[model samples]
Target: MKGSSKTHLRIVFTLGIIVLSIYESSSQFLNDEFCGNKEVLTLDYRKKPWKGKNQFLLDYLKKIDYKDNIDSVRFRIPVKFWIYRNDDGSGGVTDERVKVFMDSLNHFHKLNNTGFRFYIREIESVNKTKRLNLGYFVEAPLQTIFNHTKACVNIYVCDFIKKKANGATYVVRGTYNIVTKSVMLQRNTSSTGLTHEIGHYFGLLHPHRNYKSGKNKQESVSRTRAYKGSLKKGLICERNGDGLADTPAEPRLNFLVDNNCNFSGQALTDNWGDHYQSETNNIMSYPTHYKCRNNFTLSQKSVMLYKASENKYAKYWNTKDSANKIYHFDIHEPDNTVKMASIIKSNEKQNHTFHKIFTTGKKGLATDKTDWLKFELNTENTSNILIKFTPDKIVNDEITITIYDEDNKLIKTINTSKQIASSQIQLKTLKSGWYFIEINKKQSVSKKLYNYSVELIIE
Candidate 1:
């Protein structure tokens, strides 16, 4: 009986090992022959902070005559590519494919006089089986690990992106978000896919923005600027669909578009009973084929320019003018403690103001998640100190900003609750002394990068 029991235990352990091996092998490799469409998993604009920012961006762009200085306001964007291969460094995207994709990406953006150009800054090769077949959930850490360690658009090209749903696996061609400022794509993804994802990176929403949700009002087919007597009152084309008047209101152009790059399907009507006339060639649309998706409307170009000029995206642009020099370089780490705080010297010549734009975040396995800054106030009169924190990227938790004295005693604590929003603390009649400011992340598991700007004003 003892010998029989020993044999049973051995058999069970061997089976367990085999099962574990199978699971690990299956998890690391994905089907590379599946057909998929390019989809962007972006932060929902119907939500709080994103909704507010979306409206604010549109309002700000409306006030700007960006076209007047179109010739001189050209932007140069730097791009870094990460090509992933198997564990032994075999079977990844080819250099020729990357070069062709870049050419196509540039050609599409150049066609409409978009005033934006992208150039490759670096190309890195990643050899890891897990990275070769990526998933949506694993992308954040992959971004943190392969991050350029500087400011530029990071694009990861993988072998396959496995997405499981309803006991079956599907492929997601690409994804991008404003918070990460990164794009992940399958190596076989079309050049159109790359361009479309970049459009989302630049803040261009789909033409059928609210079509999938069915919760909000869809853009009506009417392009009428005068909404006093419109079918859906105040639902002008400019106010509804994509916030751009040039692109007509239409449903998702997925199956409705034909092979010849034309929308000649069944007549779909909007809520106002008007026939749809969507632009199949719009880069932001979901056309059936890559060839059918290759254009950005004139207003769309303006939107891209305005969005790229935001503080969060400042690191991606290369320019020399001081007015456009608001964003600074990445802040070095190890300033996590009070004694190791980075110095913030006020520009006495500029009204005692210390303002800078920087990028910082918590690493995956790093213990330090706080950034420290020390500044001195030498004003004699009854002065006020204003500290403002404007974040370009999204922070999942409230970033706690604590004010401490020279003795390492806490003075005040301000927790910013909004995601991708700005917060400010005003201290009236602040004493003249050395003070320290601590920017700490409340989240414990986040490894995503955060870009923000701090402005210190004393008067």
Candidate 2:
């Protein structure tokens, strides 16, 4: 009887263990079971592509209208990035430390306008299991964590380990699935890290590494070809592939490294380019220091857009405002009374007069007097005409209108001020001619007003 009782007790204990394991696995999969404290959101699809390829993925991106304009591309995908500082008191994340990190990310986003909605979440979990640690053991379980998430993409951040047993500082797993519409990022922290890993997440391969399937070791020929091709096309230098078409190629050996590890001073291609070595700066390349790591090349932007379009991750083209064609023009000097002008020629000529339309004003700071001005142009006929403006100086003010040509004049003057915020004047009566619109203000301010975009209807 005693032996039987002992056997029954062991059986009960084993059953309990099994139940716990099942619970843990289920918790990882279900969103509601996530420690009752994690934040998550299911982003909605904004626009649908006409011909379906990556329809499911493309539906989620915010549709940007660039059909009529080239300077600014519209994106529908609202990307929100949250940084969780899980450093514990034993050199783990602290509030102040996390703030610094958050600030850096914010600056980078602002500079690039990658168009991801960004936010920082500080997780203060007392449970050791929920806390994020920067070691091998902590990262080991992340693979399972990633497997559990339904996200199309999962990026894991951890500290770098240099042992042969440890993988590269960054590891990207899984291909972009057009069917499932998902991808994954497995990365380790290094001096020149996250950016590179993020690049991989977007389908960019390492400049020095061969990406053919089933290949384990990097070959010299693979590295050489990447360098030579990128250089010829001006994508990246031989030192680091910065993902630009204009910058010179950089060799992989020039990358920077921290001098404390066994791999230190081992001829790394990690350093971000300095002004002396390269003229243009890109975010994907190794940075000499933290400050230098910023910006995406135009080619990279196109590639990202293409991928998003191809994977059906999101729609980039805006088809709503079809009648009005938009165009971008940079105004060098703007002030209370300065002329912003552009020559608008039509493929087919239709007689039209000039009028006012919609304008978006500048935001932040009054240092540049020109930042306060806004203007728009319209015509009654499809004939080409030079449209010009001398805006009223009011910081961050917008003007929109539809006006008729009151008088037949080659040049017309529209007055704007604090009292009269906006006005529309028609130019249909006037014949096609070179018109001058001038705004005169104090010449002390020397900043270029960018994203000064306009849309016009020929008829």
Best by lDDT: 1
Question: How many pairs of residues collide in model 2?
Answer: 55
> What C-alpha lDDT values do all the predictions have?
0.61, 0.31
TM-score per candidate, in order? Answer: 0.55, 0.34
lDDT for each residue of candidate 2 in 1-459, tens digit (9 for 90 to 100): 999998887667445433433343332222111011101111111222211123222333334422212334333221212222334433333434333333444445445655331222112222233333322222323333323222223333222211112233322221121111222222223322444434444544333222121212222222223322532321123222322323333332233423321112233222331222232245554333434456655445544555545544332222123422221212222111212222334322222111111212453212212222222344334444333332322233332322222232325454443323223444454443333333222223322221232223334
Off by over 4 Å in 2: 1-103, 113-148, 151-196, 207-244, 253-280, 311-459
Across 70-178, the per-residue lDDT of candidate 1 in tens digits comes to: 4333566657788888888888987657766676777776666676766555567788787778755445334534354456678888887776644667786876634
True-vs-predicted CA distance for residue 18, candidate 2, Å: 25
Q: State the TM-score for model 1.
A: 0.55
- Clashing pairs for model 1 are none
Report how far residue 298 has shifted in candidate 2, in Å. Answer: 0.9
